[model samples]
Every structure is written in structure tokens, then in C-alpha cells.
Target chain A: MKKSIDAKKGKGPKAKLSNDQLLTLYRNLVRADHFDKCYVRRIQAGQLISFYHAGEGGLAPGVGACSFLRKEDILWPHHRAHAQGHMLSKGIDLKYYLAEHTGKTTGCCKGRSSYHWSFPEYGVFGTSGCIGAGFSPTVGWGLACKKNGDGQITMMCCGDGGSNRGTAHESFLMANNWKLPIVYLIENNGLAIFSKHEDMHPTKDIADLAKGYGMPAVIVDGQDVIAVAEATLKAVEHARAGKGPYLIEAKTVRIQAHGVGLPDLVDYTPRSKEEIDELRERDAILICRERLLTEGLLSQELIDQIEAEATQEVADAERFADESPVADQLDLSDINKLVYAE
Target chain B: MREITLIEAIREAYIEEMQVDEKVFLVGQDIRGGNFPNTTGLVEMFGDDRVLDTPISETAMVGSAFGAAQMGYRPVVDFMSGGFAYVAACEVLLQSAQHYFQHGGNVSVPLVITAGVGAGLKLANEHSVTPHAMFLHHPGIKVAFPSTPYDAKGLMKSAIRDNNPVCMFWHLALMMEKGQVPEEEYLVPLGVADVKREGTDVTVVATGLQVKHALEVAANLESEVSVEVVDLRSMEPLDYEAISRSLEKTNRLVVVDEDTERCGFAAELIAQVVDKSFDLLDAPIERICIDNMPIPGGYLEAHVLPNPAKIETAIRRVIA
Candidate 1:
């Protein structure tokens, strides 16, 4: 059972990833999961200002993929940006995010975005609740990268439902027209909030939209960390090489309800019990751990250490959130200070 | 002081700002030749890197301007026409303006969204109609409607230097009008009103091209009545003081706006005057604005835009 994990790819030698780098990514995912869990608990305790509906799944995809990105790159996420924010913990202090959610002073965006999304310094621009609204701004960042001749590219994350928004189409057309270096990631987690992708979109393949715009598109198993990472690295490389825009459709599953308030009756209604169970079995974190263990890349001691450290980090973040200051109405004045002379 | 057309004044402002500040640049559709002639001579002066002539994508252009401003550059975006602002509304009103307060004072979006407002030429419905009311309703935005060449230069310079997002509406017809401007660097403060003329019998609150028309109507009727004319240079943080002062002096008020009558600047001004300066009123406030219909074509355009005849009628009614 203890085979070399180095033979991951078809190449004679698997590309080596530093242990520190792997640990950082794993740690970020744990933090993301902890933040979302705390968000659910706080909402249940009625301590939150706005209710975000991304509590369905555990940690896996959003945080997992985000952990692989460079800190300087721009990130545009949809309404379900919980894991994304958590994974970028280094870029965004968790206290600010919690404060924002709880309408507190220490919130990343104060309480202004309490009713909606946030924009931390982590290059994560505010999330678009309006389906595909994040595409154009992300494209703008990509254009900025091209203009500045910087190696940085923008990552636009949206759901299957957002793929149909006219703004998203316009964003792609313009992105191709100007050859803006960006990566469009579609999380086809079967549902766009309440509506299933089948009922929403006429075309089954969302990635095909990229080809019409003259951009390369890829479909990947989103639940598989290695698959998602490989696809992302390819897209990142393409953009870095000035190959213009690319799209990746990640087929994943939301193992829970759309958000915290989903009626228990609707659970597994759209999806078969067997399918749901199978998807859940393929949890991204579990898959990564199993792969590491089976390939002998990580020992039991190392795994235990990571889990314990991640748990401790989550506990610390939760304590920080609880002790954070609540936001006041006068704090709204802070938002206006920088608009003009202040 | 040298004389220049409204277009020339805006161009000079861009040129002067670009020459002085390394952070200032231009972005818009067809910005190379200065789309609509507002950027004329800019490409020759600042080069392509700064004066970016973008594709016909309002969202990209506006979004790019928003990003660039976030990156510490002052972007003077030419949205071309008022209608185009609707396309980039998400970026301007929602993201650009709202971000200042929404992001908890995290980002400074020093962007100037310039567009041609009101209809004088027969450009028909798609091109005409003043849509500034939409922006005025939103906080965190500075809206400027300059009537003359001088105000255009001064206000634009002020807009470029200001940290907040400033929406500048320049009437297309006034683009060719000439006015005196100071040669030295200067900034006309935001949220301030300019009293174009002094009077006592009645007050005329005007904005954009209507300010000119109101001034003309007041001049023609000078001997008969002393009409006070106040140009609402800034629409959002409206110079309530100036309007209130005028209302206190004249008692009779007539608000003239280039935009439509419903939910327009006139409505807001009248409401404020009635609320704060109720005791100063001699008669019920009147408004001179376009009919609540789409901007018409051919001969109807002259009929559609607020005219001196309409202002005169409103003034006479209030004073009578």
C-alpha cells in the first residue's frame, strides 16, 4: 500500500510539490470549512447581520482550488464565496470577514456588505449575488494584467445558473475580443440555488460556450482535487503565456442544502440517494488524504499533525470572531470618508 | 484667460491633468480621436498607453476604469452618452460609488464618468434623454452638470483631483460654446452651487444646458422682473445652502432641469425648498422640465428639451 506518490501523472517522474506548500493548501481548506461552520452556527444563534446560503457542503472545492492560487492574483466569486474567502485566510484576516457577517466594526467590509458580499485585500473582489455579474470586472482585471504586462491573471468563479446571464456572455465576447488573460470557472454543482441546471440551461455543456468565443474550454471532475488543480494549472499557464482567456467547467456536488435555511424535506429530492451518497464519499479533503496515504506521500504522524493544527487554527479563528466588536450605525460614516476629500 | 469651446475646455482639462499628474489617464470607446471630440488632441499628447481607445464594450470600459482607479490611477472615462451609463450601471452606481462605503472605506475609486446628457440635435430616442436622476438617487457619488466652457474645465479638473467617483454630464450642444477660463491650475469645489445672476423677484434653479437657457430668458425679461438664476453645478450633494439662500431671497422659485419631470432634479429641489425653506415661499414652487415621454426626433427635439419659453412661463406663474 505504501507506493511512491511521485507517480501521480503519466510522466516518468511526478512533478514535486513541497511539503510546506501542500500543508499550507490543506490548512487553508480546514480554515475555510471552520469559517463556514461557524457562520452556520452564528446564524443559528441569530448573531449575523446577513444570511449567506453557502452552508450546504463541507470544505472541499472553493477553498481547495483557491489554496492553489497566487496571493496577488485577482479573484471574482459568486454569492457562494464562503470557502473562497476562508482559503485566502492569509490574504484576508478572518476577524474582518466575521465582523462583516455579524455587522461588526472589525468586519472586512464593515457592515455595509453585511446584507450581501465582501471585498477583502486578498484580491477577492466582492461576490456577485446576481448570477454572472462577477465576469466583467474579473475580465477588467485580466485586461489590467495585460496592460501592465504583469503575469497575474483573474479568476472568475460562478455557478451553472450564472452561465446564462447576458452580462457573462458580453464579458466573454469582450474578453476574447481584447484577448484578456482570465480563467472562467463554472461550478456545475447540479443546482443553481433552488433550480436544477437541467431546468435552467438549454445546453447541457456550459464549457462549450467558451469555444464559440474562440477560447479553450475544459470539463473536469470538480470533486477530485488533483483533477481541478491540473485543469487550473493549465488555465493559469495559458494566461501566463499570453494565450488569452480560457474556461473550465468543474462538475461537483453540493452535499448539503443550498444554504442553511433549506427545508429538510427538499434534501435529496432532486438527487437520488445513491448518487448523493456516492458524491459525498468523494469528498475533496478525504480524497486528498486517501491519495496521500495510498501513495505514501504522507505518514500517519504527518496526517495527524495537519488535522490537529488545522483544528486548532479553526478554534482560534472562531474565538477571534466571537470577541470581535459589533458594528454600529455610525460606522456607516466610515464608508463615506474615502469617497471624496477624506 | 483664454477663450475655448466646451469641447476644447474638456480636452485642455484632460491634457493639463495628464501632463501634471502621472496617475491620470483616459479610457472609453473610440477614445483615441476623442470620441465625440471630447478627447481631441489627447492621443497626440499622452500616447496610446494612457489614452486607451477601447472596444465597444461599456461594461469592460467602465469596469476597467473602476479597477484602474482602485490601482491608484485617476481614470477619466468617456462613457460617450447618458444611455451608455445604464450599461455600466453595475460598475458606476453599484460597484464604483457603492464600494466606497460598501467596502468599509477600503477602496478609493477616483473615477470620472463623463457623458453627453440632454438632447438638442435630432439624435432621436436612443441617444437623447438625460438619465442623471438615476445616479443622483444613489449616495457616494458626485454628479456635476456644467453648462459653460469655464465651468466644464474647472469642474472636470476638480473631478479628476477628487477621491470619490464624479459623474460629469456635458450637454452636447454646449460643447461648441466658448467661455473664459483661468490658465493656472485650479479646482472648483464639489457640492457647491454657482449663482449665475443676482435678482429679487423670483429664483430660477437650473442645471446643464437649461442654465444657459434660463439665464437668456432672465436677461430678456430683466427690465420687467429681477430673476435670480442659480446653476445647480453639483446635483447629488446639491448646494442646499445656495438653493435655500435663493429661496429665502426670491420667495418665488422655478426649478428647470434638462431631465424629465418625474423623479428629476426639479422634484428633489422643490421638495427640499418646501421642507427647509417653507416660510420663505411666496407661492407654490413650479418646475420647467421636458414632458415625461421619450426624447423625440426631428422638430420635436426642440420641443422636448426644456426651453426658455417654458422657464419664462413657469417664472411668470410663480411671480404672478
Candidate 2:
């Protein structure tokens, strides 16, 4: 039996973004794509050896979910692309992010963290290297926001595979019981490393788990940035109004292997080249560009400019990272002092 | 000074800290109704908002603490029992412990974890296991196991005020033990050791309930063997200087721990002493512990769990 996909609405009629908003979405999508592509290129060239899960094919969910977030809104980035795409969309320092990836002293973490970027100054808490580590903390942050009576919302990101974990169940219960201002954005790429999501999860949609805890949620086209943002905006509004948590299950696809240097096989069945080509038919960046041109939201010239600027931005970040010095002996000698706060 | 049990001391510390700091809160299972006598009236005093009663979800509880700590709230998480910490091992042992170091040292996880450990309760394998060794092995967290009501109150207060993650364990056996606690505020300070009894012939170092056992053995052998009893209040930032200073006077070492024998706190203590103060030792060091076996059912635990008899024998062997 074919499971029907419904773009469930929450506290609003069919939501829509203005032409300018659509254009901004396109701009963000293009920038995220550039960052992801550069990340893949860097890994392929062996300029960096950090453990990474590429965010190229699965960039739309994070980019869209973060589109409406304010500077004060807290975010726990997903593991893919070292979370650079979400960081870029959320307005974090791009140079420090890249520098951290390359293990330079000017990095966001001062070269201490290899594949993590935490800019708490900008309200972006570095997601844990362990999957689903963000679930409970997001609830913690949301509880704080609700208690403070502030309109800040916490966007907690996790893969579809991690939705079945214990933290997910427990976090959902607490958020619902307390009516916290949290948005659980579950990005379903249909794979957990090599294990198929279908085999691991009993439910068809990850948001169903949220529903079990009496939490409100929606299912959207993961490849459509505008659709995701529109849905996320309604969820955010509901949360900002103190209506517990809202879950979003984005049915996306993993275009390649889980991480660089890992097998491309999904549960021992190799992902065919044809399969990847078919998945790219809905390339988020390309789709957004086409929509902007078709809807008269943006001209080809403007689209070209956006692409060029994003490319240049990524290039400048690469140069900044490459030029930064590696952390030296002095930093290593301060290990004891670094671990604890005096 | 007021006489109180270890549990009462811990409760008083929580009440005092929460009274002074608005950001300090308590979260655990059945804490509001006071599943244990310590937290019985906390909810009524602080209200449900601060004294959070959570479900049997260790991960979410710890995660909430970790998250609240990130937001500058000092959260004291009750695992109910020491073994329950393993249920959320990733949060307490890894993520929260390593957060500050991995996230550029700017963030502080000012959270306190308290749970009871030791085999006297007779809850069998799962509940009786002493899980402090794993926390001690992890670098970024502080491990403080108190042996007396006085130290328990002071250490709990210090752990609550600390800006780092601290795992504190009290022996279930010591819950009834009474000691003098000050009426005013005082902190034992994390990572500092206290010499429970001063002597001159041999040094017996112990932790948690074992400290009491070691102290008992020292008094019994007082006239025959001058035993100096040192209580290592905190295991992580061990007071190695204090240990070495005691060893300098006694020239013999014996460690008593109620936890496992191998790769546990006792082993770490001996390894550190041999490395830093090997010249101060005249006789080979001795360790009295549960030799690599889980604490069996109630009555059977005596065979494996370290007791006063084992400690006394170890002290005699160390000075033999």
C-alpha cells in the first residue's frame, strides 16, 4: 500500500511566502549548496581529515528550517556537512567555521574541535558528535525560553534514524508536558549510515513518533526550501505563542554514502549511479532557481549574481582557513587548564 | 555544629544553595514527593518549577540538566542510584563532560550529579554496583565521593557551586552514619583530600564507605600499628600531595575501596602513588576491593565487598 504524503497544516491555512521571501530562500539555498560543495571538494582533495557527513544532498531541510529564525533563536545543528550549511544560513562567522574544520588557531573552537562548530555567541550550540545528543538539551533550552517568557524558540535538528532513540521519546514527553517553545526538525534522508531507515523505524514518517507523545507535527517536501520554510514558520509561530513543540518530518534522500571514506552501500546493496542521478532530479538549489525565474520572483541576472557571490564567499573562507596557523605547542601544554573552568 | 546523617547533610546543602542562588534547581524521579527522605519537602519549599519530578528517563533528565546548565542554570540531577547513571552514560559521561573542552572552553556545564552506591543495600547486581570509576576515568568531569556527613554536606555545596560537571556518590551504607555539620556555610572544596585520623606507622587511603571501614581498622590496631587514615574525598583531582605527604611520614600504603578491584579507583590511586611517590614506600602497597566481580545478592556480598576485616588485613600486609 502506498502511504500518502500530506503537508499537514498547524494553526494556519496553507502558508505562503512573499516574492521577496522566496528570493531570499533561493539565495540561502544557493549559498548552502556552495558551502556543501566546497566541503565535499575539500574532503576529496585531502586538505582536511576531519570526520564528516556530507550535507550536499540533504541541505534543504536545515536551510529552510533556519530561514525564519532570529539572531537570538537557539539552534543545534545537524551532523551533516559539519553543520556548516545551517551555520551559514543562521548567520554564523563563516571564516571561523572553515578554520575550525582545517584545525587552525582562528577557528570557532580555536582549533580544539575538528568537525564541530559552536558559536554560542550567535545562539548556535555546537551539536554533539554523537547523534541525537541535541534532543534533551533542546528541551532544556526551550524550558528556559518559556520560563523567561521570551519569544526565543529552539530548533532541534536530528536525522530520521535518531528519532527512534530514547532521548527523542523522553524529550517529546517533557516538551509536551511543559508546553516548551521547541521545534523538532527531523531530516529523513532514508538512511542511517548503511542501515535503511525503513528497517530501523517501524513508522513510515518520523513525525509519527512526535505524535505518539501528543506533539503537533507536519510532513513536507524536503527538497522544496520554500515549502519547508513555510511549514517551519507556522511551527515557529505556534511555539513562540507557547504551544509546546512542533515536529517536522522531511522525506529527503541521501545522494551518496553516509560519510566520506565510508561504503556507499545501503545495507549491503550498493547505491547505483542511476539511483543518485534520479535523486538529483529534485536538486534543492536548482529547483529554487527555476522557481524564481518561472514565478518572476527573480531574473536570471540576479540569480547569476547570487551564485557568483556565494561562490566568492566560499572561496574567501577557504583562503582565510588556509592562511590561518595551526594550533601550536602552547595550546597543547594548557590541556589541564582547558578542560575545567577555574 | 549540628549532628546529622549523610542524607540530611546532602539535603541541607541543596536547600542552602537553592535558597541563595535562584538559578539553582533540582530534577530527578519522584523528587517532589520525596521518594527518598532527602527530597521529601523540597517541592513544597521550592515549588514544582524548581524541584522538577521527572519520569524514569535518565537521558532526558541529564539532558535537561545539561541544557539548563548551558543556559547558566546550575542543575543538580539525582540519578536515584549510582547505577542509573549508566542509563544516560552518553550525556553524563561523554557529551556533558566533554562539552566545555570540545566547544572552545567558553561554555560551562555547572551541573551536579548525585547518586548512592555500595552493596549494603542488597539491591543486587544492577543497583549495588559502584559506578564512580568510569566517571573518574573521564577527564573533564569531577568525581567526589564523601565518606562522612560533614564532607557530604560540604562537597555537595562545593559541587553545586562549581562551574564544571561533578559526579558525586555517597555510600548507601553511610546514609545513617552521623557526623557534626556546621550551621553556617562551608565548602569542602572539590579535589581536596582530608586526613580522617593522624598516625605515624602506615597510611590507609580509602573512599566513600571504605573510609569508615579503614578508620575502624586503624582504631582497632592503634596500639599495635600506628595507622594514618586518609580519606580521598574527591577522586578526579586527587589530592596527590596529601597522599604523598602521608606516605612520607608512614612509608607504607594501603587502599580500601568498595568498588571493583581492577581499573577502579583503588588501582588508579596505587598507580599514581607508585609513579610519583614510589621512593616513599618501604613495603609493597596493598589494595582491598571487590576483586573484579559484581556484588552478589545481599548476604553473599560480604564475600566480595571490601569490609573492615579486609582493610585491616591490607594495612597489616602493607606494613609487614
Residues A189-263, candidate 2, lDDT per residue (tens digit)? 999989988899887777767656777788888888887898888889889998788888877778868887788
Candidate 2 on B1-320: residue-level lDDT in tens? 67998999999999999999999999999889876667879888999899998888888899889888888899999988988999999999788898898888868899999998889776888889989888977889999999999999999999999999999998888898899998888899987899999999999998898888888888899889999999989988888999999999999998887788888888888888889888998999998889687778868878888888888888778777
List clashing residue pairs in candidate 1.
A96-A108, A100-A107, A104-A327
Instruction: DockQ for every model, please.
Output: 0.48, 0.74
Q: Which TM-score value belongs to model 1?
A: 0.91
**Whole-model lDDT values for every prediction:** 0.75, 0.85
* Best model per lDDT: 2
Error of 1 at B219 (Å): 1.2
Model 1 chain A: lowest-lDDT 10 consecutive positions: A1-10
Give model 1's docking category. Answer: acceptable
